[model samples]
Target: MSKPVIDIAIGLLLHHGKVLVGWREAKQHQGNKYEFPGGKVESGESPEDACRREIYEEVGIGIKQWYAFDRIQHEYEDIIVYLHLFYAYVPDDLLTLIQQPWTWYHRDQLMQLNFPKANDTILQRLFWSHFIKIGDKLSEFQPHADSLFYWRVDAEQFQRDVLHTYSADDLTKLILNDEHYQQLSDDLKPLIKTLHLKQHQLMQFKKGDLELGKRYIAACHDLVALQHAEQIGCEAVFVSPIQPTQTHPHTKALGWTQLEEWSKQSQVLVFALGGLHPNDLAQAQLHGAYGIAGIRNF
Candidate 1:
């Protein structure tokens, strides 16, 4: 017989840039794992009511506002869980009311902790939406010419300077080579808005493997590369060398005509890269390009 699903309500309480998490006690179902504090819905109780009551019982705090985030179903060896997730804004002063051992973790730090297998799907969705929403909101006020910024840096430079200076609101995405992508710490991964991968790096993994719970864009120079990126469900693709570039001056440029032809064929958003300047944005868009990416032009 199939296992029955247990309906549970969970809340992610956010304060500042962190979310509240509690360490499960030894006697609990998923012992020693970190979880967003919540419990199963009682008979006749709504999910939101259960969530609020559970939080008060567990941590002695009352939350007035929460937005429904997602509903996830996961099957474990013994039971199937139907988790109803919600996101709420909590006051900093309410931290003193926590009765159990709890900590406020930044989005990046949550990846390093041990969570129940059932929570993985909801966790990924939460962080992905969090960063993307920030990016969308920031873009609304910025100039159209500054819509995107390409960050091309070595691993050392990224950690030493880029991490300290730039934030998700500061750039559209950070493009990294294979070596630099591999060198990033687990705690730093969630802070990335959209991570751009080189062609070879993207080829090493299947659709879901390269997903670090972030939006991904892949570099493409040919039809095969573009198709591969689309097959893997990349958010965007970068088609380069539209004009002579100082970095690769020896290679011939794919001029506007070819760039437009390729862009029209792309299943995913096409970013016109290589020798691009702010002045080229309008022209690139005229040819079906989503946006332009560059190294020094920004």
Candidate 2:
């Protein structure tokens, strides 16, 4: 006989640099562990609806907006669980209502606490919140420590040169834009583990069509593109033109309000791109970006 599969909706509430977490009951299946607020998904209820209901029931607060983050499945001795994770911000006025067993902890403190084994992947993704550098020349840009690179040069000769210039560990950080990525030689392809998809390429993408074990990131402009990215299993999406750019000054920027709206609307991790610098990190986070992607100021 097989164990029943159960669905769970989990919510991670962020407010003033802290995330809400609760302790599981001692007698429960995964007891005595600290967990992001959530509960089982009931029959006939959607995961998003279940998440909202669970958070309200457990924390005494209502969440009107949330962005989907990631999902995972794990099997314990008794049952299999499919976990859907979402991220939302809690208002300052409601902070006082979050009480005992449900406490707010700084992001850094999350890893130190005990959580269910299935949470390992989500925890790691949160820990490595990113910054991405997008451009041609490596020497021309100085990115933050441990930042990822979106190498956009398309010349086949230049692409190979760049790939061979960095060590394997360093190459792993590179997400080659589609043109350069497609031009790689068979041997050189394994050096880079991520692929950056242009809007058109993303439209044609399907699971199993690309090499396995690599991460795919899509360039998304709006909700429709974002939904497509999510459906195709992109690990992240670059939503661009957050500000008018030097490259295209006449192109109207999305501005902060629209950026925040896109972040709320999409489940995939959102990277704010265009006319941004490292200094914009705090401002971008305030609007709910997973990271910032830029060319000159990376």
Candidate 3:
């Protein structure tokens, strides 16, 4: 007999650099394990609505806004589950009012807790830092344990120098632009785990054309492209021109409202790019960005 399939909406309530999680009751299916607060998605109910309802029902906190973080499918002995994850930020004042059984754990501390097997993927992803640095010269910036580096240099120079300096493990925190990625040899490809697709590249992209193990992230300027990125298997999208930039001073900025709107509309993580600086990370997060990416301020 086939296992029953279920859809679940999981919320990672983030506040003050921590996530709100609850202990699973001993009578529950996955008893004694810690789980993010959420429940099953009822028939005819959208995952977003399911998440909002479940969060409120389980935690008694109502959230008007949340960003799509990720989706995962896992199978247990008797059932299959499709987990839809969302991220919501709760204010400091509201954090104090949360009831018992819901505990705040620092992002790093989550790894130490015993969670259901299905949560392993999200736990690894949650450990990624919220800042991405984009630039042409890799040597200009010092390496950071938590941050990701996107080296925007030409394909020839990248292939010639990158492998000699960084290992496959090191490349996990690095991102290569699509142009450079396509030019790399098959053997050299595994060294790159993340690809950053430009607007033009994303427009012409076809699924399965890229390597299977790599994570694709796209640069988008509008809602259409952001949706397209999600449709084409992009795990993250960088919505750009959120602020005025020296490189394109005359280009109109999308601003924070548009950023939040697009973030809510897409299923992938959203990064606010273009003219954003390190100091703008908090503001970007408030506007629904998973992080901030920049060429100069990173």
Candidate with best lDDT: 3
- C-alpha lDDT score of every prediction, in listed order: 0.68, 0.78, 0.80
Q: Give the Å error, residue 5, model 2.
A: 23
lDDT of 3 by residue, 1-298 (tens): 8899999999888764568889998999899999999999999999999999998888888987666767789999989999988777786567666778898887768889999999997887665567888878877544555678888887556744555576666767888887887777777776777888988899898644544446678889889998887666666778989999999999999999988888777656788999988899899989888888888776
TM-score for each prediction? 0.49, 0.59, 0.62
Runs of candidate 2 exceeding 4 Å displacement: 1-129, 140-144, 185-187, 207-211
- Please provide, for model 1 over 1-298, each residue's C-alpha lDDT reduced to its tens digit, 9 standing for 90 to 100: 9887799999877664467899887898889889998999999999989999988898789987665656778888888988987666666667788776768886657877899998876565434211111121222323223244445555545553335345554433444444555666675555555677788877775654554345567788877888777656565678888989988999889888988887666546677888887678789878867667665564
Clashing pairs in 3: none
* Best of the two (1, 2) by TM-score: 2
Candidate 1 displacement at residue 286 in angstroms:
1.4
